[model samples]
Target: MNSSASSVVDPAAPPRSNPIRIGVSACLLGREVRWDGGHKRDRFVTDGLGRFVEFVPLCPEVESGLSIPRPTLRLAGEIDDPRLVFGDSGADYTEVMRSFARARLHTLADLDLCGFILKSDSPSCGLERVRVYGKGGMALRKGRGLFAAELAARFPLLPLEEEGRLNDAKLRETFVERVFAYRRWLDFVAAGVSLARMVDFHRIHKYLLLAHSPEHYAACGRLVARGKALSRAELREQYGELFMRGMARAATRGRHTNVLQHMAGYFKKQLDAASKDELHRTLDDYSDGLVPLIVPITLIRHHVRVFGLAYLEEQVYLAPHPKELMLRNQV
Candidate 1:
């Protein structure tokens, strides 16, 4: 995954401060734990994204005492009541897997994981469109893997994705953004969340939320403003849920362009005629699909430094994850 030369750090960019903890399917990290003792190592995940976060690699089958090169397993019966069983022998291991998932997730709950990336199309790890087979040997692609289903049900708000889907630029950006935001929320709580702190949190993430869903931004603001009536626990729980949910929506190019325009306005007083024109042109190029998102974002960041715009400099929307990952360059 470490394909390129070392990345040159951006001076205006924030220091690599936050360390997001994420769970990855063990095989994706190049562990030979698959059914045939082969691994689906994802270089982008291990080399690119791995630079920013600490990965907790997990293998449900191996951890559940299943031997490598074991008989292939599949989900059988109705979609709602599918059993994890050997495909050829019809040997049921539903309880074995479910029991392992339950105990394993209980341990993970305390790890404060921000997200998980599972192996795609795996009998025990896939998330979307997994095949479910019936007694008549008919198959439907509507099933979720046993371990992945448990993880989703337990931590409904945690960002989760398949290694295969991360190939898509939009989904990759959305997941990485959510992971950082989720960690920020966790850090807020760890610092002893207070009314004033929550307000500051909402303020910093305001534009970021607007890029995802303006309605959610307004709803979150209302939640914070009406915090006087709710208990501290209630405020913490409700606001956390809304904040994460808001960030979960994929930000569209139109929405991003609007946010860029809004952000550019902050430099109106400081930028000279030439500088303003250059910034506007860069943004237009990005909006017109002629340039990557990093172009406009870099310009805005430079202005933020030159103009001493402390507020915008501190805003997480500008640099959601590590620039070393070069995530924005792709999106």
Candidate 2:
């Protein structure tokens, strides 16, 4: 899950409760998750994302009892390939790391985590590009960290990143988008999604979905139309496949903001010129990075709830009858 986002209490952010749960490398947040008990302490992570995400700091090694200020570890074999060993002791900790990871996975299961920011180059948590050792003092291919490997195996659909990558704006946007999208999906599942519920769920996710795949968006609408013909089991399987496929597509700010602008048209007649113009300006400003897309989208959604057109709000996809389309009222 990679297109970026989130909500928390920050000066620039709208106040939010139940902030998205974000799994972080404990050391990175000054929690002393490192071998020697010193923390990484990232401000951008602590201040920037921490403002929105409920940080779940984890130190796999500490959990594994390797003690702080210990000797560094490395991948002794291959990445996604095998064997993790301690550099000095020649002690293989693969089984131990893997075992702890499994336990950690169970703990993570209940967190309703939207995403994770792993420590870079960590044997336990690096996301990508970790050094894989070949022979003595030799580095092989770059691969994922130990805990990261296990975590990815467990939650293949969850959004993840490393501190290094968050520096890039595009990556940040993708991570943000993916995490919230995951959150929305979780909300759908938690509500016991059915065909109608699924349609409603998709409606809220429409703008973000379109940013990923316009074609998929259209196809999803058709699939929703097939709800009556398909059973819940069938729909789940179908939608799950489509969801993964759509996620594989990349996201672009220009494309998203543009589609969002078109969506704003749904409210034009119902709103005054000042409100319309203001929203349009807000959308445009967000496109330029003056603010986040969430701010304007939230604004429109508020107006949408107040106004009563089903197409104007979350009802656009939730039809009256299986054959009754809410968008039919669209001007």
Candidate 3:
């Protein structure tokens, strides 16, 4: 994690009661299990996000019976259907890796994972832009690792990102937000599904959904409205799909500004003229890139408490992830 992000958790902020379960590349946690017996340990994944999440680490190459300090492997052949081959020996491990991944992912599905963090540019775990060499020995950075591709195909809605990409402030924020949200959804389902409970979940996440995609928010609202008519299984399936799709979209500045303005309306009858002016100015500053999102969010949260806006106080958008991550400070 960046130093700025590391310092954001308020001392008095309510601690999360439940830990989010996430899959991660084993080497990211400082395990010496890479092909060369060296780890690509990422402090952001291990020290920052790790504080809030329980990682289920796996090293495909090592777990598949490959020796440490083994000959390096590379993806070769067609981009869509690459073969995992030793860099120097031309030995093939494609089928072995695929079979191992299929079995491992099936096991993971039972683990109730909310997200996954893969190692970047790994032959076994990179999520994107992995180099695939052509028959003539030229490399193209358009392929995903075999295991990463399998995991995605198996759990299409599961939040997944590479440790390398998590270095970006925006991507890191979105990934952390989605993981926590997914964990909440899982807990909701585990508590037993009901139309009334579905409505309650939708209500709390309204503005959070709006920040990502207005169309998805509308679709999800409509889905909840039909809750009493649809069977429990059908309602759960459809709602989960829409919820995941909506959060999968990056929350852009324009969309967030609109939501922030809408939230500010709740405090209009409660704020004095000066306070109102300050709120609007903060929102405008955030919208104009002159201030971080945390500025408007912090002000709105204060107003919500002062005015006792119960509904607004409960909104997940106000505290999507742990404040300690300081994700909004970056965006």
Candidate 4:
């Protein structure tokens, strides 16, 4: 538990005024920008997550001066430094694509993007497992797409995921959670970096970080404890890196159960025997995989409200993203 006596403010308060912005592949949003002039529209990306975020769509191939219905392109040569070339004629477009990516990434830096959704298996946008061909025309799925590589290099901390990978419930929830957390971090930085604000930020995110990574949570707590001795810039950079890295880690059943138990401690004196038994059963059910995460979380939320546990209420672990997304329903 956080030792700070400061009042905890809701981290989600900032984004309520400003829309969360996310960068995405245009084709995933139902744009006809693919090589075949047809879009690989993902309903989840278009109709589901689209409700909360404003997407900044980009098509690397089309935006890089390539025509619609253009010849197919593949990556060839060294896996580390592959060349983007036309499939039939092997016409190289490595420099053209790289140059475009550099300039376009510069423009995107100003958008304050919270996350990005890329096209899977694309020569220009795949996050990983992109096919790279050898001298004999044999291909290996070990290369990352050109534009995706650049985007990653430029914004190492930004939350990024391939559209196809979002089909998995756990991965989808983690990615969306990171997106909202990243936005909250951005909001914190924009407000100003001070020891007080840093302490408040660390206090609110304590449980959320513990579920993902207990090690990082402890590390961040130590940093905040001694923040007065460190420069503000050093504190901010280190904390931001640790926070995002922790969030990137997948929160497993055991870790989540640990957090739930820790949160339950707050309501120890307030709950009667039957209420406590009910909470324990819900936690056990969640641990045994008899119910989804939403079940246990809903009970905990109800207890928090009934007891008016201000600290637990401020914790982002209960409501990381919008409840309408139902990310916790499946996981």
Candidate 5:
């Protein structure tokens, strides 16, 4: 938002040679691996986001040597450490599933996944609110699937969501943004992290981070300022943690309005009075929830291009994910 000459303008990085990779529950991709030999294919997962990302599908039950049309599974016992068991007969398969998860996670570690989409309410792949059974067969929606839990532990910073949750526009936008951001972070690390690289990364992501958390934006700035004092490993770890956590925070309408206002400041000297009023009204409409975020973003992006605001053009906040996704249109 700061249009100061000192503001870093990162050159546009070359497009990635490899497609972004996303891990997904096999059933969500229309794989007939459910216990009943059916698939829970989500059109958005396969038809929408799938166009941009290469999916690495995994069906825990099938991959764990379970047969199709097998007995349905459920989580039972303590909420903290539930057991995967047959829904009808209560045959425990906890060890089998966990052993498979541990080994499979090691394999997934090498895949450089940007995000994961899990089947909602699945016994082995649900991201959250999966039913856990207790004594007397009482059930509570307090469990996470075994494989999902393992994946979360292995990659704490990776973006993850349930297919059901993705139906919500705001959640979907946030998830996709994080996935792309994570991919960029991966590329940054792959290219070799340095103090200078960290500064550039922080610079390009400035407005995006500010939209989510001004506090975190300032905290990250402080960390980058002291980057020379810390070891590369420490700086990378601390900065990466802060950046991802800030991204995970919900970008409320108020926060988004604040960011929009800050970005609008750059066009003050360049725009005519009528154009300024139009932009102001657009921002106000967005703030009032009368329109989606895409409206103001589109106008701001147009001004950036026409005026040749290279610094703003480089900001990831303008286009975090592919436009084809239309994530910001609804949110």
Candidate 6:
């Protein structure tokens, strides 16, 4: 559901450099792969999100040799034994599909992918809420796509999502944010960067992160501190786990904006009771789940900008990263 959370297009911005590698269904970009041989043609996915991610399109059925305009299909029976069949003609090629899924994953493994956007409800790529049944197409329980399930099982570290759900502004934004951060992690690994370097890398994100979940920001701090004694591999593995876990919390606009204000105060000499009380109200609103995490975060960011916190611009919270890594998003 690429339509789930449509991203806002920033036309005035320059093209983003060193784009994040994103795997997408061919149909989502208007490539004709549907059984009826048409496309979903998501402009937002192609143009908006496309701004920062270099999309790598995949058409499993076509790649698997299924005919275009063929019968529509759905998963039947258990998840592991999910069989894709032609609804009207009862044409079943379970073996062909299994092979296709495996082949696709092998190809995907080589790409320096940070995230994926699969076609939703497809037997091949739905990330969640997949249809399942009992022996036959009776009752359906939401599960993952056959190919998607295999890919997820194999590469548990990679981030995945569905086109259908990308329209939800919050989910779309959060997923993209995490993907960007993941790519940064991978870049660090490839460059032989150390944990201390990685620690410095994330320092710039300190206040911005607090905007989402203070618990996450605090946990990351502790995790970074623990990394002091670890090897490169250990630090990357541990930090990635902590980061992804924190990313899963789905920080709403309210929660982030509120905490952001308090964090901005971290740079200030002091905050009056009124200032503290206002921050408390924002946090209360967030804990109560009354607002989106980004809303408050946006406000907090505004304050940081207005006050001209010079150190923030220098990535002070993080260690030295690949020089370009820090500025990659700026492009």
Best by lDDT: 4
Model 5 error, position 194 (Å): 0.9
TM-score of 3: 0.93
TM-score of each: 0.92, 0.74, 0.93, 0.95, 0.95, 0.76
Query: In model 3, what is the error at residue 209, expressed in angstroms?
Result: 1.0
- Candidate order by lDDT, highest to lowest? 4, 5, 3, 1, 2, 6
Give per-residue CA lDDT, model 3, range 140-218, as digits (tens).
9988998999999999889999998999998898888888888888888888889999999899889998999899999
lDDT of each: 0.86, 0.70, 0.87, 0.91, 0.88, 0.65
Clashes of each: 0, 16, 2, 0, 0, 32
Name the runs in model 5 displaced over 4 angstroms. Answer: 1-14
Candidate 2 per-residue lDDT over residues 13-66, each given as its tens digit: 212544578888888898875776688888778977776668888888888888
List ranges where model 4 is wrong by over 4 Å. 1-14
TM-score of structure candidate 1: 0.92
lDDT of 1 by residue, 1-331 (tens): 2223233223223224645789999999999999999999999889988877889999999999989988899998989868999998999998999999999999998787989999988879999888999879999998999999999999988999999999999899999889888887877897897899999989888778988988889988998999888888999999888888889999988899999999888876677899888987898899999998889888887777666676776677887877777878987
Q: Which stretches of candidate 1 lie over 4 Å from their true place?
A: 1-18
Clashing pairs in 1: none
Which lDDT value does model 5 have at 303? 81
lDDT per residue (tens digit) for residues 171-280 in model 4? 99989989999999988898899999999999999999999999999999999999999999999999999999999998888899999999998886678899989999
Segments of candidate 6 deviating more than 4 angstroms:
1-17, 79-81, 88-92, 211-219, 267-308, 314-331
| Per-residue lDDT of candidate 5, residues 277-321 (tens digit) | 999999999999999999998998878777767778789898888
Q: Candidate 5: give the clashing pairs.
A: none
